[model samples]
Target: MRRTSLLAATGALLLSAAPAAAAQPQVRIHDIQGTTRVSPLVGKHVADVPGVVTGVRASGASRGFWFQDPNPDNDPRTSEGLFVYTGDKDPAVAVGDAVTVSGVVSEYYPLSSGETPETTANQSVTELTGASWQVTGKGSVPAEEIGPDTVPQAYAAPDGNIEKTQLDPARYALDYFESREGMVLRVDDARVVGPTDTHRSLWVTTKPEQNRNPRGGTTYTGYADANSGRLKVESLAGGDFPAADVGDRLRGGTEGPLDYSSYGGYVLEANALGQHVPGGLKPETTRKQADGELSVATYNVENLAPSNDPAKFQRLAEGVVRGLAAPDIVAVEEVQDNSGPEDDGVVDASQTLTKLTDAIAAAGGPHYQWRQINPQNDADGGQPGGNIRVAFLFNPNRVSFMDKPGGDATTPVRPVADGGHAALSTSPGRIAPTDDAWKDSRKPLVGQFEFRGAPVFVVADHFASKGGDQPMHGRFQPPTRSSEEQRTAQSRLVRGFVDDLRRVDGGARAVVLGDLNDFGFSPALAPLTDGGALTDLATTLPPAERYSYVYEGNSQQLDHTLVTPGVRADYDIVHLNAEFHDQTSDHDPQVTRIQP
Candidate 1:
């Protein structure tokens, strides 16, 4: 998706000159392209360029067509193809038509206009603006094939300097996109990684044997190492493209004109797409309740608010009741303020909870009671006005919440002895709320509960998101994750709290569970696992079934349930979401059975 920015400046490259009767000089497409990403002859008028039409798009902010030279020069960095932008006017150019075009060269940046605007410099698409076209002949245009087999591994260099990336299509994805920009690309038998975006952009990987996770899906191991095989296919030429899910395959091949967009990075503007082959991953069956076992699940409901459709609340209730087997307690994250996304100084979410709990009862589930500490106004980071925070939903009939006072947004909860038993000073308080590590992120919610006369302490956390982290396929070779440091400190704080409980009572049962926002294999998680105070339950599962989230065709874990010693736990990562097209969240709900 495109980041929010003002439109970029579009210079008048084409001058209104009188029609010339004499034949204009013919220039090769590569000469106008010059060897740099920014065209050398930008703002200069050129004429009588001959090429065969490879693809055409007659709609949207980018209304144009693509053509490729029949013959090319010696410079591999110079592209053989070019785009002719008609600017809301129809050029009447069809695919397979050999035509001569006369126009001024220009560089189009999606968002570089206005007084204070943002532009993707050195990444703008070069094109022929305000162009006039004449058909010379009609014939078939062969497209440049791009797949795992066609692209050379040697050319897969590193991404950075535009000069070095001229022909390094095999080593880096950005280089590959630049080298083939504005040309027709054909991908045969590619696998879909990410689902279609709002602009109908589909991400796919040419290498079916790409480095996969233990769950038979892709994983983000490193920067270039993880995303060298993926590509984004955008269909802005109009008409609906079929929606796809992770692990789905595109059979019969997909072809499109390669172009650049500010939001989607480099994309193939598809006029046609192949048939969608399903991944055969179905919804999971509900978990069965056992006699001596108490089920606790953590679900990130994805910013649920009172303003959302009542039907949305109903669907979530069904998932909680059916998919999670009506767990005795659910650590819910992303519960928004009652006013939803509207930032009106409203902080309480009692109305939001009322609607959700009402739906659970109507769906034949236990009447669940929720507890949470509302962050001051916009203290917790998430949707600006939404005031998203972590909460807990427990069945009052099954478990009793030990109610105590002294809990608020800024107050830090500490472990204290209650009737000779280890307990929290505040029943449902925040853990290290004022810590610098949690500057603007969601704070951990701690609670004390008694299930069947056994005391259990729980901490529900929603850590800092990976928004500012460098992408897996960025200019840097091994991209740096700026968000990891904050998450590491937060993890250590939570681990320290768990260790505190153990110090009070050697046989204390504590659970730390929520959307951790860090991978199970990442070094960022070492602080929580290194000391052995707690163990991530995902480590106990077979590698093939350890994931709780599916992203870019990779089965990974961003949510986890870590427990202390003497707490025998059995967890099931429900696959009702992530792998399916219809999902309330990108993460699958996970249920853990704890015998305290």
Candidate 2:
């Protein structure tokens, strides 16, 4: 429900102290320094400011260079410039070089953190034109001499208050490094804890110290060696640097080796950070049905909800029972529910689907039945509308629900972390779930059905959203944390499932349908077609009728129904009324008739 904006910057404007002076054509260092304010200037040209380079640190392949006024006492405003660091050029300015930089002060770009608000602190820099010269002035001293020495702060600490407990060295070292964020802290009596395949490093433990606040209130303080503490850096300027040893003095802000949490953490690389990881439920084989005629259809029942009041369950029984096609098997996506009354509230979608089955039979339609995989009670992803899921509706006369294999039949489904959770997988990418991670909800539902006299299998898939397309590429920027990869994996798993079925029953039939979160031509759909397992129904229609959703005022097809080669031969896939583009659902329905 929270529509993600793929826009690069949030369009946040920093208020400036005053308007640009009319007399000056270009902004000068004095103009920026004279004003005690910041402004948002997306495409403005500014003049160069000269200062002494106080610090130069290589970040990945780029260098973060900081500068201070020649007369620090006279000019209080500090300035800095960042440049992409290529190894070919010797850095013109060292720690003590005087350099002048001319570039526009730009707004910070936001980084994605699954389930967290995007973070903004680092700004982007471009068009660097500067000169550097060696300075004969006194050099800046290292950070340690400026402050008093103390024990390094450990990453994790015991639950008990630090003041009362005696420090246990071994356990202390193990826990601290595990809990601390990316920051530098001094440690005492530190020892090598473990070694990773890439580097050998030590985890140090330190005791807490008591300190007084500005109001003379006492508090506990921790330390780091040589002012040594963890500093989260985006990356090293170059690759494969030597690891810091156990006894090595660590400067609090000095960049160090990457940590486990680094991938989804604060210091992520610009290129890799804030991306969605893909994931999904992997399908298990179900019972095969006997040969018989069956009917299957896919519907994009636009945003079907329980009611205006999110608290009340919207009755879908009437709609399903009275639907024009009266499908024997229905794959409905975007069936919405929510935690609040104003939003799509707690209408049990499974129960609604069940009611619809009974309603259809009562209305002289087929005696249909249904099954659904509900998202977790706590899985609140979509915006104010609550949550949406795909449900399977089938005629009992056509198919029987088989117990999913390889798992306890009665065992309750568990809510594994979605791409939103960092601890779930280490792939550094998000893919849709292909397993039973959807015990709570927010996953595709699968089942086996008997079509009159033949066996048929179906997977009701509702992929992640391709909400906003990227301006430059005209493609939906996949979600952060490898989310696109997870979806890709889910597609592959579906293809594999279909392939396995064909292998078992030389001419087995299968159907895949719902909102795929992808276009007909997307790379994610390759697996389904590559093995000749599924054929897209949209391809049967003329170019004008292909799309089901609209973006940037243009209609695009995202909802689809695909059939296996064996199934397509006997069934005619039809796209229903989609021209209205109404609010009932974001997608129109597509019905398929299986011949006897």
Candidate 3:
């Protein structure tokens, strides 16, 4: 590729008429888009970059015009397009106008509120700044197509190094973005995976088939693979655009310059969007299981604090009654303290549970009795002062709690043989409370109950979250899941408790439910499901419908339920939340009915 190093000097003329004046060196647009994320000639001044203006963002605080070379070099590692940042200058250059500009090459990163002025993990976008351009000639913009055939595979190369020279441009999203950083490209017949963000950024995919998940976008289940086909389309035309829901298709696709932003990775700032194709997804109806069978459910009530919007409590109650059919017991996660988001020493969620139970009753459901142990102040890892802990809401008429002196927050509950039946030493107790595996994470809440004269044991758990994991588009090829180690240990601990119950009685009706935080297919769950001691009901569902949570664009299962043999259980994931735009919780409640 051609490379030119320009000195940071005053504006120099490309062609000097004076015999004594030296001619300024010219650099190809591809040269400015170096082999890496940062330009090779960054901080240096370059003159006479000839290309056609593809698109322009004249207004806004971060405004720039997109330009591309009509004829590109055969080097696939370098992009032929570049963005010229015109600070408050109403550039007279129009689309299709060939322009020769002079500018200092530099990388620009938009600072987040309270963010420092240095490049950390979050801020990483390269751009050209302090530019001045002049229209040279007029020509039609290039219409190069980048479809499924050209995009990279969802998973990065097996090699661990992201900085390794990009051998193939259409193999990984990171490599593809590096190869075509500023190039003007088109995604024909793309499918919208997620609705537009507040900044009008829409996530879409040109390949809707190959590595596609049942729910529009791709998944990170097995190999932590990302959907390389998925791309973000940012429209800076300065007006409200109708948002597209998941499964919607964009015929003719989007055509624009691919750029990077701090919030989202490489995005195609679309100048034109094609025809809209509706996905035709309808809301699911309430479920109906056989009567007389005690039904239980698991729901992560997304930081349901008392100070939250009153409508949130109402919506959750409606979802529990109408959507989930008001299960006999609900293993609720993220139940903040009575003070809600307030950071006082208060750890009781009685007021929060009472408000929720009262709402359920108002919604024509039976009055629900709740049980939980208030966590130590700031001990449980959730919103600070929120003291989020797992709790159970049970209908006394259907099933009654087998109370045997509940354990405190720091007390660990041990399994004991009770009249040849498996029984917890302490009801509504914490399992392995002081275990290092649960070091700042939520502890498993164990409760024993009697359903129709038969004793059943249930455990409510909220394992370590996947927040500490690396992004799919990080420097590591297959991003390491550092959070899985702690979760695996936590799973083993729960399984040990479950095995104890089964040891007391092989025919034990043990039910494990709540927001496990790990996927059913992830290796972190092998400890619980490997030997078949516990069967995950979600895995038995049709693969496409196995998810209970929607993140980014993939509908995945973060909440799960496992039951012992002889306990015939059927599950129904109430899709009232997650998929819908107006959601009270990020997770859909999973209802399981146990027929004794």
Clashes of each: 12, 91, 2
Scanning candidate 2 in windows of ten residues, the lowest lDDT window is 422-431
lDDT of each: 0.77, 0.40, 0.77
Candidate 2: lDDT over CA atoms? 0.40
Task: Please list the residue runs of candidate 2 whose C-alpha ends up more than 4 Å from where it truly belongs after superposition.
Answer: 1-293, 302-305, 308-324, 336-351, 354-367, 379-387, 397-441, 467-483, 569-582
The TM-score, computed over Cα atoms with residue i paired to residue i, of candidate 2 is 0.43
lDDT string, candidate 2, 1-596, tens digits: 01112331142122234555567554433333221112223345454455554444443333344444443223322122223122233454555555545454432232334322123221122212222223444443222111222323332233322212322323333222222111122222222111111221222212212121221111112112111222222333334322422122233333221122211122211111111111111111112222444657676554555443322112233334444346677887766653322443354565445544555666666766666655544352444444566667776665655444322222322212333321111111112343533223245555656554455667777765543222211011111223445456667766765665565555666677777767666676677788556898777764444655433222356777788885642323232222221123334455666655
**What tens-digit string does per-residue lDDT give for candidate 1 at 344-370?**
999999999989988998998999999
Q: Model 3 clash tally?
A: 2
| Comparison by TM-score, 1 against 3, better one | 3
Worst 10 residues of 3 by lDDT: 1-10
Better of 1 and 3 by lDDT: 3
Candidate 1 wrong stretches, greater than 4 Å: 1-27, 32-46, 73-78, 86-92, 102-123, 130-134, 151-166, 212-217, 221-224, 262-264, 542-546, 550-555
Cα RMSD for candidate 3? 4.2
Which candidate would rank higher by TM-score, 1 or 2?
1
Per-candidate TM-scores read 0.86, 0.43, 0.88
Model 3 CA lDDT for position 286: 55
lDDT of 3 at 18: 39
